[model samples]
Target: MFGNDVRLKLKMACRLLGGQKSVANSAHIDNSNFGKWLKGQPTLSEENIQAVLTAMGLPDGEPDTKNIHCWNIKNSFLNNLSSALSLYFPYTAEMARAPWVVQGPSLKDTLGIGDAPNTLYALTDGKTRAILRMPRSVIIQENNVLPVIKWRNDTPEKSVLLIEEIKSGWVTGVPTVKEFDLAWNAQGHQVTDHDVLQAIKDADISNKEAVRRIKQKK
Candidate 1:
């Protein structure tokens, strides 16, 4: 329901967030231009409007249709990760070694998603805080250690689904195709975005159903 009025939406969003600066940071708008927009000198672009909606958690608008889909992908990632962890049980403690994707200043910087002027997610687990190492990437300058969750007795189907969700999240929300390829390759996939996406799409059928049946058996 995002109508043709960019200024109105922006003003309302700013009020919702308490001010222009907060909205600007969340929308990834830099200071100078954000001031300009507030002053009515230059309006936001279509792409920027969508970015703002995504940042404001207002994905209910028409501009955020793709974002809604991306959010769903992220949720699926969390659910699947949880399922995998459940299977790992006594062997897998949610203690220190559980690797989960998070939104934060450090992660955004590490993932090369640009500065957002705030840390949206914080690692609060005491045990995880004791042992977490920032991921090393040849591309990303941030020292944020990559968190990798290790689990035993994992299935290929589960693995594929997990990666799919992860990749899809980046593809739809944050990273570029080249960035996606580089990140996954650094994680040792050695595959392009096209390759991974195709694999994800292919795995949507028999393999997933088979995994569901296997889980049911268990």
Candidate 2:
């Protein structure tokens, strides 16, 4: 799951920054090293992580000692700091705060396209966007609105199971797109991408789930 999280975060970051080249430059790492790092291998040092966080425009500070147990680092403070950075400066945050217009599919539809292949758009504020693809087989049914409580970020078991169940339902004739964001009442309001990504990460949902949930009531 850590490996998966890293990959998803990296992919989202790349999309937010416009391209792989931009991410590599912004993170101060080369393409080869970046690829390796995303694969759960840290070819760079701790300072490199700091540099990447800074590149992402997130707050980088000394680690906090209290929240160390939740992380896997020698310095609990730094670990906590890193986790906080990842949470606060998530790919969604970068995209949300970007200067250019970042656009993507709102979970219900793929960039206003039909839902046959079941792909989501990953757009930047700049003139760039990529398709965050998902398996069409995971969709349970279209227009299925599940409660948002089942999609929180603290419990991984429930999140993973819900996503898998959605996929299962999809395989058994459930829709691929499930509406999961009735929590928000209005449209065009402020919905932080950081919170969205964290929820997906904590819940172990795929990018498909992320886009689907956000576009529910809009």
Local accuracy of candidate 2 as per-residue lDDT tens digits, 1-218: 33657555544544434455676797778778866776778676777766765554432532222211111111111212222334332332111111111122244442434434332211121111111223332221111112211112222222221122334222233222121121111123345878777788999989987788879957
Best-fitting candidate, measured by TM-score?
2
Model 2's C-alpha root-mean-square deviation from the true structure amounts to 18.9
Cα shift from native, residue 125, model 2 (Å)? 18
Model 2 ranges off by over 4 Å: 1-3, 61-218
For each candidate in the order shown, give its overall lDDT on alpha carbons: 0.36, 0.36
Any runs in candidate 1 off by more than 4 Å, and if so which?
1-6, 63-218
Per residue, candidate 1 scores C-alpha lDDT tens digits across 1-218 of 33325444455435424456776787787756766664566567767766666665454342222221111111111222322222112132212111233322345555657522211111111111111122321111122212323311132112211133344333234444344333333333446878755765677756577567658999
